[model samples]
Target: MLKDEVLKILLSSGSHVSGQDISNKLGVSRTAVWKAVTALKNDGYDIESVNNKGYLLTKNKSILNEAEIETCMHLYDCKVFPKILYFNSIDSTNTYAKKAADLIPSDFLVVADTQTLGRGRLGRSWSSPSSTGIYMSLCIRPNISLEKASMITLITAMAICDAIEELYNISPLIKWPNDIVINSKKICGILTEMSCDMDGIKYIISGVGINVYDTEFPDDIKDTASSLLLETGTKTDRAKIISSAIYHFYEDLDTFMQTEDMSILKSKYESRLANIGREVMILDPKGEYPATALGIDETGALIVNANGKIKRIISGEVSVRGIYGYT
Candidate 1:
């Protein structure tokens, strides 16, 4: 806890503060401050210690530790705080979140440095290299019908877009229900699953996987996948991105729950939609069809103009090729 406090102080202060000043402010000893600083340095924080100037956090290439994420949330002044469970390595965050859903808070989160069995939409394998990507799942207990669960995926996609744009200054387009793409390559994927009965909904686990600093992907997905480091040529602050996304997701979810309609968020989502007004090949179990995407409807369904008739596709896989070719 003292290390987290020290990190918060160092991150908030623009200039270096003496050990005595930090100790006096936090009501701790100078020795304790030194210990905290040493721990932080061991956790991959590039802290600069000057003889007369004290300690300064010059760079933060830290992993997705719980304390670091809480510090970022404190910096942003997030109102809705969630209980975070962090793991250096895990089988799957979603699996753990689901197993602990009954014991943890409704706004609980499970974050892992790597997932040995990470999954994507439709049970596909998601490459989650250790300490190179973000693998997190938020367990939410919403007071809504089961049919409205799909909208939460769209909400998360928009929240991720907001966070990425805030950090990188680059806008990523959303590919239908749960994929975020940059330069026609997949950078993030979201999978939302729920448990419910006939009465209403119980809990929803929205898992998000982001390739933050991965330079090399698996051979199967090398051409289709990308990372923030590969796309922007910069190492991203994973803690800050996570905090920003959770903050924005809470704000957007509040708005969505109030209206129970995607119309309030439709324009913003459509503006970043990759397939809007573009030719797409729809893959459905019934049949495959070629159509031009119009936009999303109020309920978050894909509205496309198939041939001369209009079609509202509830669920399917779509392929689109632009200047970057098919993905």
Candidate 2:
């Protein structure tokens, strides 16, 4: 508790302050200050405890850390609760938040360290490994119409691209409808679900999962799924990555609010879509011929210029695997 209070003070200042100063400010003993620093470090905060000067929070070694996230999000007006409903492991953040959608605030974040049964676009299982990724969901209730609702996924994908490029210096390509691929391997996925009533929309839970720290993936996805640690050969801070996501989430949300049309987020989305302009094949169950990868449409539909005609993909039932990259 003292650590939480101290972290609040330090994070607010955003600069280095002496230990004696922190002790004097908090009205606690110097020994107590030292104790709090150790506790915080044990809790995964990468703090530099100097001999006489003070503690320097080098990094937030995140886990199910709510307070750490709040520190980074001190500038948002949405009043995100970084310290609420955190779990080390759970079934699904989206499923958990959907059950309590009506009860929680609009921007409430439900994050888990690992999800035993995480889900994707369809009923596909989302693999969430422990301490290696960010498995989280946010509940949002927008005033947009149903027709415009389809654009939220595109907006989110663009935001994901921004965060990835900003934080990792990697430009992961966006697979239309919400997938991020790096080196032709999937490093991220977004799962958006909604709950509605006859009156109007209740809320939508946007769940995101990213592979962060594994050098090798499960056998089934060994050739497909990859992580930042695998690609970069270094373990990335999960909290900073989450902060990156939130920071852009706010910016993209602001853009969405201003435009109120998903069209605004399209260009950026297409720029990162690795499938754009590449020769590709679509696995359509209707026994249809394969389509060529043209680009994504405004509504985040995968536009495949097939046989002198253009086909817009709006659903995930059709599989679009790269002919050259993915085997």
lDDT of 2 by residue, 45-157 (tens): 77776666567887655454666666655644432333346788888998998887877654677878889998887688888888778888877787766555667777777
On a 0 to 1 TM-score scale, where does candidate 1 land against the true structure?
A: 0.91
The C-alpha stretches of model 2 lying farther than 4 A from their native spots are 10-20, 23-35, 44-52, 58-64, 75-84, 198-200
lDDT of each: 0.86, 0.74
The alpha-carbon RMSD values of the candidates against the true structure, listed in the order shown, are 2.4, 3.0
**Per-residue alpha-carbon lDDT of model 1 for 127-180, expressed as tens digits?**
898889999999988888887888899999999999999999999998887789
Q: Against the true structure, what is each candidate's TM-score?
A: 0.91, 0.86
Cα displacement (angstroms), candidate 1, residue 61, comes to 2.2
Pairs of residues clashing in candidate 1: none
- Highest lDDT model number: 1
Best TM-score among the predictions, by candidate number: 1
lDDT for model 1: 0.86
